[model samples]
Target: MSFLKRPNDFLFRTLVIVASVSLATLSLLVIYSVVMRYVFSDAPDFVEPIALLLVIVIAMFGAALKVREGGHIGLDSLVNKLPPRGQLVATAFQHGCLIVFAIALFFGCLQMVEATMEDRIPIIGLPESLRYCVPVIASVCIAMFSLENLLALFAQKQK
Candidate 1:
């Protein structure tokens, strides 16, 4: 088994389940909202904001898990054709870029959360900062995964 797999098994599986269930719930919420609006001429005020939150949860956590699995979409056709050393260089570059991006995103999310702490969603009155939670959490996960891959790359070279 790969070195990274065991370490993340529990968290990764939990994230997968959460992302899947959230997406399913989002779909149902939207359907119910549409039906209520058309049939009753009124819909629950919570539906739209909750759906928006679910979208962020689904997208961010799912993307983070994909990063953990090293399965995030990439342009690999040219990289695959490179010689072994060239491929290593390309992969290291990619991981480096990912690490930088993840760190930047994490901090950006933090700032957003801080700035929005007092703001509230119109319907639920939940703090607007809650929306940034997914990005903040997912960015940390992405950064860790990228750093692990970077370390593994160097470890392989040493061996």
Candidate 2:
């Protein structure tokens, strides 16, 4: 468990850092874009596409981080009322659902990435698949965290 904890902690911390940096970059980009548009009347053409990518990074990474922290919405009040075994089952079910959803998201995003590989983002000229790649990475993280939680739940049950 300690060994698993170390890697999981590292992953969680990395996600948090990535999300924080993305958010800061997105904020600064928005401010710069606004100032350029309003004051200089010469907004950069690349700003919109770059900002869109940054937003995807912030949102997907943030959601993955929330899963690791157990900060996402859950029916805790309802689960708490159940017996210990029932609570365990409910928790396992929740984690299972997250794992399943993350897997589906990953596959779906992969298909999107493949389908859009030849298309370029309008202003940035980068492959349009770049946008979907963010979700693919985030979904892997989400699946890992959910699996970790699910295993921990079963381990606790055994104890």
Candidate 3:
């Protein structure tokens, strides 16, 4: 009866671990840099890129988990008062909106990546590819979340 034995539980825990590690490592690095900067009067040039990369990585992994856990911003107060069938309908509609948002974001991200190929960050001069990969990952996460939600909704109806 371990929760992680369930497939969804396993996936959810894996995602949570990954996101937590990414953010924690970033936090530690930032703290170390700050300590060095104050104590030794110097810091490495790579901190900014590393920090930004950590932010993107954490956000990409965390987004799907947030959606799966129903942690995303929502108008749930109104829907909460509805009857069971009405709630299901509302959920279906809400998931439909999520699907559309994901699709639009996916396309928009593609356009951005295409337009920014020649551009580069000023400080790190990292390739635009590195920066724009975030949107691509985010779009995929959002799509996955929407699919999972719909599946859950369907299964709920059967029960």
Which structure among the candidates has the greatest lDDT? 2
Which stretches in model 1 have alpha-carbon errors above 4 Å?
A: 1-7, 156-159
Each model's lDDT:
0.88, 0.90, 0.77
Residue pairs with clashing backbones, model 3: none
Candidate 1 lDDT over residue span 28-53, tens digit each? 99999999999999988899899999
Better of 2 and 3 by lDDT: 2
Put the candidates in lDDT order, highest first: 2, 1, 3
Prediction-by-prediction clash tally: 0, 0, 0
lDDT of 1: 0.88
**Best first by TM-score, ranked:** 2, 1, 3
Off by over 4 Å in 2: none
Which scores higher on TM-score, 1 or 3? Answer: 1
Model 1 error, position 73 (Å): 3.0
1-159 per-residue lDDT for model 3 (tens digits): 233226556667777887899889999989989988998989978888879888887887687678777777677998899998888888888888877888887888788888888888767887766766776766666666677778778877898
Task: Return whichever of 1 and 2 wins on TM-score.
Answer: 2
